[model samples]
Target: MAEERLIIPKKISNRFLMMIGLGLVLLVAGIVLMMIAGPAHHDAHGAAAATGHHATTWYERFLANLWLNNVYFTGIAIVGVFFTAVQYVAYAGWSVLIKRVLEGLGYYLPVGGVIMLLVFLLPIIFTGHNPLFHWTDHSLYEIDGPNYDPIIAGKSGFLNIPFYTIRLVLYFASWIFFAWWLRKQSVAEDLNGGLTFYDKSIRISAMFLVVFGVTSSLSAWDWVLSIDTHWFSTMFGWYVFASWFITGLAATTLTVIILKQNGYLKMVNANHLHDLGKFTFAFSIFWTYIWFSQFMLIWYANMPEEVTYFRERMGGYEDHYTWILFTNLFVNFVFPFLVLMTRDAKRQMIMLKLVCVVVLFGHWLDFYLMIMPGTLRGDSGFGLIELGTALTFLGIFLNRFTKGLTEASLVPVNHPFLEESIHHHV
Candidate 1:
């Protein structure tokens, strides 16, 4: 089994590569559709637009969708490393067999970093305008300039491009470095077969947790929260993390199930699935708690500043967001809670996959609500651009992820937990 896994079956590896071709075709088709449809397409969604913000154009809508996926998938990729760090520091044995899966997922960090950088940097380079983050527009800080905004200018110290870029680079560099170091140590442990690598990994994991705890929140602020420019939430960072964690958990769980269905991870079984299921179920509630807490606090206070975020989504973008808002709650919270409630259900692959797919797409909509309302200024346009961008990201992510799986032996033979994991019973 170890010998076989050392080289992934072509069946699985090629399957993901095929997604790349399919994704490219769809992406090109989408762009062509946009060009033919012209800017008039989005004007219909004007169909409606917000009062205080600039009108959204078609390509800007394309860029907004691009940025949306960048943040959404980046979180899923980072949480892979976060999950691995938690298992190591907590001395978790049950996850040993699936650690490679987590690592494979984390491998996307470097690529995701590049995509995020492009989304942020390209518009500024070509047009000197920040299509995504309104605060990033330099004119907003031009004290005497007509476009000057005192509120946005006040945030200039932290939101300035140089500082923001530095933080963005800092986050990806830190995440990528730890992800590489941990994977290196894991492979080393597999070769040497000893406690030395394991002990070293725990120390590395502890350091990483500290780094991640700080960066996760700050990155969320820089990437998502800053988009609003005016609204702030004390729990926004945590809210983003919760959403990222569950989406990653679902992706990880779904990958394991897929691998098992394809005859990989022979050592993993129902007990492991249950554990993953419990993680998905618990975090759904946790995310709902964060969602409600953020909402309730704002709604209760009805303060203009804090309430503006929700107001923009519910009151202003109500036409497009209303159904999506309810769907987000049902799929992310209500569905997961009730469906995964039974012990047997958690152990069942069919049920887990259903919930995982729903959670994955549900949170994408969650991020859509976060980004589109602000960027499009109430004109919510969902079409080929959104679908195409998402498909391209999905294909690229899966391709990178599956290729990583082939790099290491799926089973961590030298792991101290290997024996226990093989016999692991819930």
Candidate 2:
């Protein structure tokens, strides 16, 4: 008998590469458009210097804002891919069936790194002050500066540009290194078919999880929470974690179902779907709990600083703020809670996939709500730029993820828990 060959399918890689190239092109084009539009200050002050309908440049500002928001949202999805990989490594589950799907997703980490680097460097590169991060205002640290915010000044040490850039580099480096190592080990198992590969993964995973937790928390603080420099929450780290965790699981479930439907991973049956659905269901509730806890605590305390966050969201943008709260609660909590609570729904591919899609979009909106209100401010209507950017990233992600699935054997035949995973129920 001849040994089986383990070659990755070429078509999948080609398709993925093409989509990735398209996404990069769009991302770069969007950035250029934003740069051309210049800062909001120029538009406001130079209105008299323009002509005709282009005089106000309202359309240009709108496009710039939309593209910028899309950039941030797509960046979140990129983070989602990274988060999924971390969880897989941490659990060391027999997710061999979809491990390549995750590895494919991992490819986006470097892309995400580029996006993040662009965002972080944009202020300096373009000489445009970052509205999202007040600490970036170097003049504020100067002795005679008049535009300095006291709060930002107080935190200058931790939030300085150099420190911020260093932390971000470290975070991206750690994630990329760990993701690459784990993928290498998993693929090596296919060639070696020995317990040594599994042992290596186990040790690395244990160490990686500890590092992952710390870095993830800091990254969330640096990336998201710091947007509102005045507001601080001890639970903010866990709050962001819960959102990403649920989103990552939802994405993973969606990928699995899509592959299974296409006849790629036949070994993953309803039982596997059921297990994935359960995680989606449980995490929905958990996310709601953290959300409410954060909201309720702030509401009850009613401190000026704390309540200001919600007040800006709920009072200033009442319609969107209300809609976001309702949609997040319903799609992430209510719908999934009702649908996935049942044994039949969990086993039903259609229903499970439906729930997964809802959860994924819900969390995307959740991040949107968290970000846009603070960043885009008054002109935050969802439009073509947002949708286009999302489609661009989704197309790229799916292309990469599917190719990864076809790269390796759908099932890890040598995995110790491969049979257990196939038999997973409830």
Candidate 3:
């Protein structure tokens, strides 16, 4: 069978404009709320005075929202490249049909990397405040000062600004290089047929995987785990990888469905969709196992330092955020486990799409739980600010992905395994 080449749609519809408009409105609203709430925070005095009372304000919550979202989107982008690279390493044939979609999803990496770096730096430059990360307080390292913290001071060698910034640069630079290199080789392969580009890609992909395995963990530790300066978890990195991996699976599944509905990816059939569904189902369970292991080990040890992480979410502010744990587990694990357990349900496009959407939001809430509780404290509440900010990022994600799709053949015609992917079946 001759492969049909993909054609980019000449123009995006008015619905695309509607998406942009809605994103702008939500973004503006979120920014307005954050600006208005700015005065409530006492940056000069920090979250606590010399008297040792913990206080939080709405601006801090806004900062928390920004930080959480930056990492969330970054994870999504990283996992996109991760999904593609893993397939390349394994010489997987079934995924070649929708590989372009994965590449498109990865275009968000450079964009999101810049945004996250700026968000991390904003407090230090403009306000002389570090609301998201309290370790930025130099006084904490001063042994004689009122703000002295023995724990934070001890970790300063690894957690200092210079090293942190360097790692940030290296992580983004490395991921961007791999993403760009792979995409370039893929398009080049189309122009000049043969396995020359394909052979280079395999070697590059192997190197990328080794680097990603290490940096993904380091990045997770730097960005999210450091939020609570006192707590530590050896399992934190793998746990984070699982969350975004499953979430990325859902997003990829949804994108394929959308493309097929619009008369693209015609080669992808029920069998392909079923395979995607199985990944979603299996990873959901894998994520749950990691989630439980992390929680259970900490709970059993009963150490104040480690247990405080959960304690804050459970008892702090009357359990405002505790319910998120249940919701995350239900939507991500239980919902998929029960719904997609049967063979028939895996091939049902509508049900799979719905579950994918649900799992995406569920993991967003999972990240929210991880970051928000550390900074928001008594001020923690889910409202327009949080919802609108998420909407803004979602719009950005979609806009970039759609624009990226237009740049390449929607199907990689020269890929050696295209035929296998086209005729893929259980």
| Best candidate, TM-score | 1
Q: Order of all candidates by TM-score, from best down to worst?
A: 1, 3, 2
Candidate 1: regions farther than 4 A off: 1-15, 43-46, 50-54
Please give, for residues 1-426, the per-residue lDDT of candidate 2 as tens digits.
Answer: 122223446786676566656655765564455457643323221222221212223333343343344334434444444544554556645454555555666666666676677666775657645655656767777766787677778898899888988998887788778777877887788777778888787777777778877987898788878777888988888887888778777777887787777666777778777777888888899999999999999999999989877876675543446666677789889999998898889888899889888887888777777765555544444433354466566666565455555566666667666666666554
Q: Highest lDDT among the candidates is held by which one?
A: 1
The TM-scores, one per candidate, come to: 0.95, 0.83, 0.92
- Global CA lDDT of candidate 1, please? 0.86
Poorest 10 consecutive residues by lDDT, candidate 3: 43-52
- Model 3 Cα shift for residue 422 (angstroms): 1.3
Pairs clashing in candidate 2? none
lDDT of 2 at 229: 82
What is the descending lDDT order?
A: 1, 3, 2
**Each prediction's Cα lDDT score?**
0.86, 0.67, 0.82
Q: Model 1 — which ten-residue stretch has the worst lDDT?
A: 40-49
State the TM-score for model 3: 0.92
Any runs in candidate 3 off by more than 4 Å, and if so which? 1-21, 30-55
How far does residue 348 in candidate 1 sit from its true spot (Å)?
0.5
Residue 254 of model 2 has an lDDT of: 82
Residue-level lDDT of model 3, residues 228-316, one tens digit each, is 89999999999999998998899899989988998888889999999999999999999999999999999999999999888877755
